[model samples]
Target: MGIYKPKTYMVMISNVEPSTIHEAMTIPSWNQAVNDELQALIQNHTWDLVPVPTNRSLVGCKWLFKIKKNSDGCVARNKVRLVAQGFFQAARLDYHATFSPVVKANTVHQILTLVVSRKWKLQQVDVNNAFLNGDLA
Candidate 1:
């Protein structure tokens, strides 16, 4: 029998996410990503950049960076978002207790598996910061 050699593999990774706006501004792709985030915020009317009010606590904002990958483990796009710190206010003072539920990864995987097996068309909706649609029981 002929000897079988193991295949040599080396993954080339280039999609490191920038941690700060300054870092993101240096790269063309990251800069475009940041611009996209700003446009979305403005289009959605998420918030207004007004002067800081006197004696009022203002929450800090930061940018979060992520690289979207394709099913073949290839870099598809760069995603950037502005997020609030959300930790300056005390409980019940800012606006009662805060609670937000999100979908889990495993559950998403199962749903995707079933859809793929049944050859169903897939549609996705980004529910980030989605307001309450009904009364919470």
Candidate 2:
């Protein structure tokens, strides 16, 4: 028997899904990395996947990929994400608690006014993938 070197395919954004068509083509290393990430998201409970239940709503997921570019249009990074199509989901059934702090406009205004009066510097910071920090109930 002869040794075989696996053929690779390139992922092209087109009318058909890259995975379905990949059998007839070669997949590039970059595309494989993106695919692997998508798989891990499912395995790691990033989102729960279930079949469409009768008399109930279901959320659909889509694969998203983008190539970050510099000002000169040169490729800098590759980002891949699997996101839910929110339209298919019902608020109470799909997502009941957002866990985001609820602050009224009046409350925000009052806080800002107090901050200004105290001459304190206002600062804002964001945590990346904050949802991942929470434990799954």
Candidate 3:
């Protein structure tokens, strides 16, 4: 019989630090905003959240966090987003229809004018990275 040998083991770690007390307190509030955005995206049918299945193709998402800052060097808030790994998707399988529509600045201006004339509260949201939420597979 051949000589017995023990298998080696390795542990990998990320080069990031844990949240501080200040950050810990602040993070949850920002995460709430992120969660709201994610929910809206789901409700709007922007993307589908599915399990990575075998023998078929699917994209993946990951949650990315970034600390936002104002020009005055103060921490504004934490921004989180979901992003897709688009490279893995097969073009033929994913791109059933490639029709896309574009809006000109004049159209946007008209819409804004209409909103203002209607005196409606126009709430705009800023989705940060918006492509990295979970793992691909």
Candidate 4:
């Protein structure tokens, strides 16, 4: 018999998520995702362009990049979100109150249990830019 030879395997990794806008703009997928986010914000009238007030502090914003994946570990899409740096604002100086509308896990479980016991039909709705739907003032 001939000398036995072992097979070699190589793994390649790619599609790294960019950490900055400059880096992201260079990639086509990330660039498109950024454009999509801007378009959505504009179409929804999320904010108005206004001159900065001399007395009020201006809040800075940043672009966050994320790669959404499918259940099978395949990349679904490039997601970009523009978020304000709220930490820069002082509590009493910047605004009056802060509130987060979050549902408790126990409440969700109870609702699901009730629905299951009653054999009720359940429909799920996914709202894109749900945060933008809220009124700012």
Candidate 5:
């Protein structure tokens, strides 16, 4: 008889995320994720659920989910965000200004250049999300 080998089973994982609200609701852990998102929004004073104005147009909102993990390839946290669908926004009409916190490559280079010129140590740090810290009023 030939040498016997043990059977091995492997679990497959995909980067694909949920696309619909119903799909998210079906998962037990997703409920906690949704609740955590709402809590953060409320605590951050993100918005108020008031009656829609008769003469005002409001954009639609939806929940987006992401699974974040550390370097060890383990589940770190569930991130859920409420995103506004503003594709219909008109320039200089619906809104005058849009804000984004994306960092520019030039800006990063300049900052690093300054630190190197000054012979200062560079330490990575995380800052509060600008969207959350800004005054929406």
Candidate 6:
């Protein structure tokens, strides 16, 4: 009888996400993601260059990195976001009230149920930078 040998297979995994901007900069994909986000923000006129106010405290911001995946569990793209450190802000001194608009899952389910029951055609729309379109007083 002849001895049988089992073959070894090698797999490559490359889904490691960087937790800091310094580490992200080293990777080309992450660097491009950061650039893309900056370009989008600039194109949308998200912010303008302004002199720092002497009386008010400036809010600190940080870069956030995320790996977006497709439904088939494949890496779709690298996503980056710049977000303010709201936890550092004083409650009464910095702002009067804080509100975030978000739809509940139950509400979405109810809406979809109604649409299905009424036999109505449904359409979906995705508005990029929709929150940035809000007017800041």
Q: Which candidate is the best by lDDT?
A: 4
Cα lDDT tens digits, model 1, 40-78, are: 667766655778766566667788988888789888778
Q: List the residue pairs that clash in candidate 2.
A: 8-26, 8-27, 9-26, 9-27, 9-28, 10-26
Per residue, candidate 2 scores C-alpha lDDT tens digits across 1-137 of 79999996554432323433243135454466466665666555665545666766555556565555558975554455555566665667757422322234565576678889999998842221212424322
Candidate 5 lDDT, tens digit per residue, 102-121?
34556557677888999999
Candidate 6 per-residue C-alpha lDDT over 82-123 given as tens digits, one digit per residue, 9 for 90 to 100: 776778768778663333333455555766788899999888
Candidate 1 has an lDDT of 0.68
lDDT at 97, model 4: 34
Query: For model 4, how does the per-residue alpha-carbon lDDT over 1-137 read when each residue is reduced to its tens digit?
Result: 99999995543322688999999988877888889889888897777788887778787889998887768997767778887777877878875433333344555576778889999988852344534444322
User: Judged by TM-score, which candidate is best?
Assistant: 4
- Give candidate 4 regions above 4 Å deviation: 1-14, 97-125, 134-137
Question: Per-prediction count of colliding residue pairs?
Answer: 0, 6, 12, 0, 0, 0
How much does candidate 4 score in TM-score? 0.66
Off by over 4 Å in 6: 1-14, 96-131, 135-137
Q: List the residue pairs that clash in candidate 4.
A: none
Overall lDDT per candidate, in order of appearance: 0.68, 0.51, 0.53, 0.72, 0.63, 0.69
Q: TM-scores across all candidates?
A: 0.59, 0.43, 0.44, 0.66, 0.57, 0.63
lDDT of model 3 at position 68? 65
Better of 5 and 6 by TM-score: 6
Model 2 worst lDDT run, 10 consecutive residues: 125-134
> Residue 46 of model 2: what lDDT?
64
